[model samples]
Target: MSTKQRIAIVTGANKGVGLAAVRQLALKYPTSPLNTGGSLLIYLAARSPERGEEAVQTLLDDAQLREAGVLVQQGGSVTVKFRELDIGSAESVAALGEFLKKEHESGVDVVINNAGIALKGFDSAIVRETIRTNYHGTLDVCTTLLPLLKPSPQSRLVNVASISGMLDAYSPAIQANFHAAVNKGSIPAVTALMEKFQHSVDADRVEEAGFVKRAYGVSKAGVIAFSKVLAEQQRQDGVVVNACCPGYVATSMTEHMDRPGAITPDEGARTLVMLALQDLDGKRGEFWREEKVVEW
Candidate 1:
C-alpha cells in the first residue's frame, strides 16, 4: 500500500516463457535500502486462479524469494501475487480493470503483455483462435488498462513479440503503411489488417496475398505492430511501449517445433526484464531482438 511499492501485471504466467518472465521481473525490481524508493509487487496472471496461485507458490516454494506478498529482505523483497486473467475474454478483462482500480489507487507501473498463443502449420483448425487471443485479446487488454498506466511516473508496456513477426510477413503495400505512419496508433488499420488476413485464409490465398503463411507468424506481426502504433499514439504519455522477441525459447509451445538455437525460458526472460526497468522516457517504441532494437 506504500507509495514506494511498484506494481506490475504479467499475463499468461502459469508456465513457460510467461512464467519465467514474471520471475525475472520480480527479481529485477525488488526493493533494497541501497536502491529503494519502491519494492516490486508483480501480479502473475494466468487463465485459472488455481493455476495462477500455483505458479506463485512455485516461485515462493523454490526458495527464489525471501517472502510472499511483501518485502522480507534486500534483493529479495519482491513478491509475486497471483491473479486470474484471460486476455481473450472481454468479461475477464473488464473485471481485472475494476480490480486494479480498487486495489491500487494510483495505477499500474508495468504491464508485460506476454499472454500469447502460437498455432504452427497452415490450417484453419486454429487460425481464428490464434487471432482471437493474440491480436484482439492483446488489444483489449491494452485499451482497458491504459488508464491505470497513466499514473505511473515511468510506466512500461512490453509486448512479447516474435522474430517471425518481421514486416516482410506482409506485402510492400501493407508494410509501407506501418512504416509510413510510424507514430500513429492505427488501431483501425490493425483491425482491418486482421480482417484481411482472415479473409486471405478463408480464400486459401494467404501466401498469395503477401501475408505470412502461418497464423502464428501473422498474429505476432499484429503484436509487433500494436506496440509501434501504441507507442506512437501515447507519445505524450510517460510510458515506453516496446516489442521483444525472445528467440526460440524452449517452452512447451515450441517443444514440438524443430527450431534451432532455442534457449531456456529464464534466459529468454532476461531481455524482457531489462526492458521493463528502462527509463520510460528513453525508448518510446521499439521492436527488440536479443537485447537490441531491430527493424519491424
Candidate 2:
C-alpha cells in the first residue's frame, strides 16, 4: 500500500506547517500498518484547490525531497490526493465530510486540523476572524469528521495550538486580577475567559485586557479547553484528540516578526504529525511538544 491509498486528511495544507505535515506523513507511511494498505489516501484539504495543488506541485518539483514528498499508498504504492476544505466555513466542512465518506468507506486514520489564522497586530476584525477560524472552525471540522473516525482501527485528531494561549503567558498583573474568575473550579471560568476576551474585542479595548495580540491568544486558549472537552467526549470511542504547540515556526504566519529560536515549518509539522498518529492507548486528550506529552 502506498501513501496515496491510505486514508488521511490534512486541513489548510496549501502551505506552511500544514504542507509540511502532508510531506512528512507521506514520507513516513512505510513504517506504519497503513503502509500495507497500498497507496495512503491523503485528502490534502484546503480552502482553495488551486492553492492546494500548487503546494503539491512545489513538493513534486523539489529535487532533493521529491522522492519522499508525494508518495501515496494505492495498489500497494503511495500517491497524494487533494480536496477543497475551508474550515472557516461550515458548508465547506460538511461538504468535505460527505466527499470523504463517499470516496473512502473505511474512514481516515488521521485528521489534522491545521488551519489557523493569526490576529498578530492590534485589530478587532482580525481578532474576530482568528477566533472564527482557530476555535469555531476547528470544532466544525471535528464534529463533521466524527462519524468518519468511528470505524478506524486507530484514529487521531490533532489540533494545532500555541503557547501564547497558556495562562502563564499573561503578566502577573492581569493573571492576579483575573485569577479568581479564571481559576475557579469549573469550565465556566474558562468560558468566562473567552467571553471577557470577546467583550474586549467587541468594545475595542483589547489593549486593556493585556491582549496586545488579542484574538490569537483567546483562540488558542479556547483550543486548550476544547481539547480537554474533546478528550472527555471521545474517550470511550477509542479516538485520540490532542492539541499541540508547534513552537514558533518560521513561516508566513511569523514573517512579520524578527524572532530567534524559531523552528522551520517542517519541524513544527513533525510535532503535529506525531500527535496525529500517536498511540491512542498511551496518551489522548493531552498537549504535546516534540512528540512528548505536555501540561494542559
Candidate 3:
C-alpha cells in the first residue's frame, strides 16, 4: 500500500448503478481531482462472492480500461477487487470493517452505500424489511466504517437516496419531526422516527401518523435525514457526507415499474461518481441529483 494510494469501497456493486459507479470510478480515478499520483484501489462489494468477483473481472476486462492501461497500472491506475459484503447483515458489515482495517492502515478515502431493497407491497412486513435494509443497514455500515475514514478533504461518504425520500412526501408534521431530528444531529432521534413509521404500518395508520404509505420512500427519507446528521457531526472530521437520487434508472431494482423515461445505469451513476471523486469545494451534508445539490 503506497502512502499516496487512495482506497474506496462501493456496496451492492455486482450490477446496476452500483456496478456502473464502480466502473466510472475506475475509469475516472487517474484524472479525478482527488488523485495524487498513486493507485486508486476500489473494493466492489456485494453479498455474493461469486457475483462480486465476476464484477471485478468485468472491470478488469473492459476495453476502455485496457486501452487506457488502467488495468495494467501504467500510471495512476485503478485496481478493482472483490469484497463480499451484505450490509443487511451486521456480521458481514463487521467483517468488511475488519478487512479494511487490516488492508488499509491509512484509512479509507470513500464509501458509497448503494445496497438497498425496494419490495413491492404495502404491508407491515414489507415496510419492516425495506426500512431494515435501506435505512438501518446503511446506517450500520456508516457507523461501523466511520472510524476508518481518512479524515481529509478527499474523504467522502455518499448515501444513495432517492427523490422519493424527499421530506415533502410526508405530512407537514412528519416533515417537521425529520427536520428537528436532523437539526439536532441525533441519529437515534431519526431512527426513532423510522421506528414510529414502521409501527404505524402495523397499525394500518401510516397516513394517520403523518407518514406516506410508501415504505421505500419513507426509508429513503430516513437515509436523507441521517446523511444530514452525519454531515453535521463529521464537519470537523473533514468527511463530505451527502445523499443522492440516481433517478429512475433501468436496473433490476426498477424493472417492476413502468418507467418510460428511465435513464441508463451508467447515466444514473454520474452524480454518484461525481460525488465520490470530484472536488466538492467543502460541500457536505446535502442531497444531490444529476450532479447538483437539490432539496430533499
Candidate 4:
C-alpha cells in the first residue's frame, strides 16, 4: 500500500450498515488517472469468511459501480479482502491482530468497531455473550490493534452505540445519580451502575431497573464508556475516538419488531462514514446522533 492510501477495517460487514459503509467508501474513493494516489484500502472483516467474500464480490460485480469506476482507485483498486473475526472470541482477535501485523504492514488508518450483537437469541447465555462481544471484545480488539493505529497521522476510532444506552432514557432518578457521578469524573461509579444492572438478571429485577431490553442497552452503555476512556488516552496521538447512536435503524436486527422513525442502512452507514473521515483537530470523544453531536 502507498502512503496516500488509507486502510480501514470495518467489523461484521457481511450485511446491513457495515456492508453499506464499505460500498460508500468504495464509491467515495474511486479510481481515476486524475487522482494519482490510491484513496482507501478497506478490509471488510466479518465473522464468516464465505459471507464476507460474497459481499465483496457483489460490490465488485455491481454493473453501475463497474461502469463508474467505483471500486477501483489509482494504481490500486479498493481491495475488499475477507477476514474472519469473531469479536466474542479472544483467540480469534489475537490471531487477527497477528495477521494484520504481518499482511497490512503499513498499519490501518481507521478502525470502526462495528461488530455488535443485541442478545436476542438466548436467556442467560444472551446476556453473557452481549457483554463479551460488545464491551470486552471491543476492548480486546483496541488493545491488539493499538500498534496498527499508532502509525497513522489521521487515525479514527468509532464505537457504534445506541440511544437506548442513554442513562436519561433509563429513569430520571438513575440519570440524576449518573449525572452526579459523571460530573465528579467517577468512572468507577459509572462501572458500578452497569455491574448492578447486569447482576439484576440474577435477581429477576432487570425490568424494575429499567433494563427491559436488558443486555443490549448495558452492552452499548459499556461502549460509550469505553469510547470516553479511549478518547482521553489517545487524544494527544491525533486519534479521534467517539461513539454514535444510529437511532433505531431498520435492519435484520429490528425486522421482527415495530420500529418508528427508522432510518435505512445507508443512513446509519453515513454517520459512521463521516466519523471515519472526520478531521482530528480536537473533535475527539464526541457522542453523536445522526450528523449532530448529542449530550452524553
Q: Report the number of clashing residue pairs per model.
A: 0, 39, 0, 2
Candidate 3: regions farther than 4 A off? 73-76, 256-258
Model 2 regions more than 4 Å off: 1-5, 33-37, 64-76, 151-153, 170-192, 204-213, 256-258
- lDDT of model 3 at position 214: 92
Worst 10 residues of 3 by lDDT: 68-77
Clash pairs for candidate 1 = none
Shift in Å, residue 151, candidate 4: 4.8
**What's the lDDT for all of these models?**
0.78, 0.73, 0.90, 0.74
List candidate 1 segments past 4 Å from native.
Answer: 31-36, 66-76, 180-184, 256-259
Q: For candidate 2, lDDT tens digit of each residue in 37-147?
A: 455667788888789889878766655355444442212244567789888889999998888788777667788888988755756677678877888888789878877
Summarize candidate 1's per-residue lDDT along 14-123 as a digit string, tens digits.
Answer: 99888998877766664422125666788999898888888887877655545443334434557778888999899999999999999999888888888988765676
- Against the correct fold, how does model 1 do in TM-score? 0.91
For residues 1-296, what per-residue lDDT tens digits would candidate 3 score against the true structure? 68898899999999999999998998888788888778788999999989898988887777777777765454436778899999889999999999999988989999999999989888999999999999999999999888899888789999999999988767899988999999888999999999999989999888899998999999999999999999988898888899999999988898735567789989999999999999997788999999999977
- lDDT score of residue 71 within candidate 2: 49
In candidate 1, clashing pairs total 0
lDDT by residue for model 4 (1-296), tens: 56666778888888888888777666655432213365667889889878999998877876656766756532236666778899889999999899988877877777888888875553566777787788778878877886678444367787888887776667676666566555555556656766666677667777787665568877787678767766777766767788898777787877735567888887888778777775434677778888678987
Q: Assess every candidate by TM-score.
A: 0.91, 0.84, 0.97, 0.86
- After aligning candidate 4 to the native by TM-score, how far in Å is the CA of 294 from where it should be? 1.0
lDDT, residue 178, candidate 3: 95
Tell me each candidate's RMSD, in Å, in order: 2.8, 3.9, 1.3, 3.5
